[model samples]
Target: MTRTTTVRIAMNGVTGRMGYRQHLLRSILALRDQGGLDLGDGTVLWPEPVLLGRREHALREIAERHGLEHVSTDLDAVLADPDVDIYFDAQVTAAREEAVRKAIAAGKHVYTEKPTATGLDGALALARLAREKGVRHGVVQDKLFLPGLLKLKRLIDGGFFGRILSVRGEFGYWVFEGDWQQAQRPSWNYRAEDGGGIVVDMFPHWEYVLHELFGRVTSVQALTATHVPRRWDEHGKPYTATADDAAYGIFELDGGAVAQINSSWAVRVHRDELVEFQVDGTQGSAVAGLRECRVQHRSATPKPVWNPDLPATERFRDQWQRVPDNGEFDNGFKAQWELFLRHVYAGAPYRWDLLAGARGVQLAELGLKSAAEGRRLAVPEIAL
Candidate 1:
């Protein structure tokens, strides 16, 4: 018989799309189905999740789907349980702080999805409280574990981007107006009052990605606009969209790399991927999307002359080589869950803590400020 360690996890806000889908079903439950993760020391660690949410109907359905008997609408009752070792919050951005604080005060280890809170101060406070309580805590930074970005990291580590210069990212596609067909995203995503906008949603992601792969962000300049004034909701009712639908931003990294990323819900896709980053270095350049990455080296460089008089005929697309699948990748969210669980059980060094999450929130806040001010703003280091 194989030895296994079972950790009880209380998952709050598991009824939302990201909550139900990523953290609950695809990650923890899937891990359970796999007989949990092997610790490589003859002990397998398993996660036992207690799903908690406000909607009893949805919670019951989700629990039944996962063969779980523990489902709760009474948060205080659930939090009082001594058996629940960890508390995970996949709640909406606005509600994250309060639930996490309660979990921390209840003596449970904390883990949560990012923009851990809507603002930087709240995020920082969570980190401080967790440290003071001497409890393990983590925040979702799933992009760092992505296979595409992982491959890019491997290249950077291997000296592929010698003296990296700059990074350019293009992300987004047109979301439907919800008149003829349903909008692909939730209606709340277009409302500023509800914590919805391109800047808040994406800058956090950019912060971690750039900081982890390249270096810390030093400064930011951004422009934001509410391109779509009205959008229909789930009830087929039109509502005024007050948030910025699009954001164009530039960031300066500590390693001297300049990163410019554009995010929008009102644009059409003409690029290679819905989200792609092209990193240019002295020796070469590479483009990485959600699942695919391609590269070009200095040795294969071709000189082209710009002439308006002549018909442009250069095979620009054929010069890059595709990166192959070196190894199978676990789902990004699933991978992070395994790591967080390992950290909880074995005291493994997991670096994506609440502090890292706060940095992401900081970037988003600064980006918005930069857009409003129409000037560059330095992202100063945050101290406890």
Candidate 2:
């Protein structure tokens, strides 16, 4: 018989889309359905979740729907519980630092969504406190675990991309201005005062994606714009969109490789996926999306003669070979949650801590500065 141990986790911000769908439904509940996670020695570590939120009614609805017993609107009360072993935060950027600080003070292992704090200093401070308190700490770096990126990482490890040259990424799709149609994203995402802006939102994603897959980002050049000037809020009221809806960035990597990525909420999509990255190297090049990857080798490269008057003969899309998934891939968020749980329970090595999160925040801060100054900016390393 397997020994069972319960780990009480206080989850905040379940009212939000990401927190509800990804963290609660897809990750925690799914883990619960799997009879908890194996500790590799015949011990099954179970999760006991305490849902925390501002709206009691919403929290109660979710709790009742999931058949959960614990639900609370009071954060202080939840943190005061000695039985609660971990605190998981998926709150908005503005409210995250204080809650996380309280959790750390309560001696709970802390895990949170990205941009761990609004700025680099706040992120670094959280890392410092976590270290001082000797608590397990982690920040969600979910993209690293995506199937497309996993395949890309495999290729890099197998020396497929010999002397990688550059990477080009295209991300984003049109988000309706809420006047005509309801905006897909939250209204807070468009208000600069509420920690909105594409630079702050996406540079964190690009930071880890670039640093982990290719090389550390040394410098960044960016231009940001607020294409959709006005939008409707959740209440169907019109408000000026103060945050940038689009950002164009060029990042310089440590090994002289250059990366350019365009992120926008105001553009239309005409690609295989909403987000796609094409990585070029001396040996070959590969394009990867959320779940699929395709590669074009040097030997398979086709030459095209420049003839403006003539129609192109080559079928460009048919040239690249699809990369197969050799193994089953789990949900990225669930995978990271498992890793964080292991890091807390069994002392597994987890590198995507608050410090790594701080680096991401650093990039976002610099990216915004670069766009504002209309000049390139250096990304200094963060130390906790």
Query: What would the C-alpha RMSD of candidate 1 be, to one decimal place?
Result: 1.3
At residue 116, what lDDT does model 2 achieve? 88
Query: Per-residue alpha-carbon lDDT of model 2 for 113-173, expressed as tens digits?
Result: 9888898889899999999999999999999999999999989998898899999999999
In candidate 1, what residue range of length 10 has the lowest lDDT sum?
90-99
Error of 1 at 63 (Å): 1.6
TM-score of each: 0.97, 0.99
Give the per-residue lDDT digits (tens) of candidate 1, residues 73-149: 88788889998999999876777888998899888999898888889889899999999988999989888887778
Q: Which one is best on lDDT?
A: 2
Q: Over all chains combined, what TM-score does candidate 1 have?
A: 0.97
lDDT of 1 at 70: 90
Residue 199, model 2: lDDT of 84
Q: What is the C-alpha lDDT of each candidate?
A: 0.89, 0.93
Per-model RMSD to reference: 1.3, 0.8
- Residue 97 in candidate 2, Cα distance off native in Å: 0.9
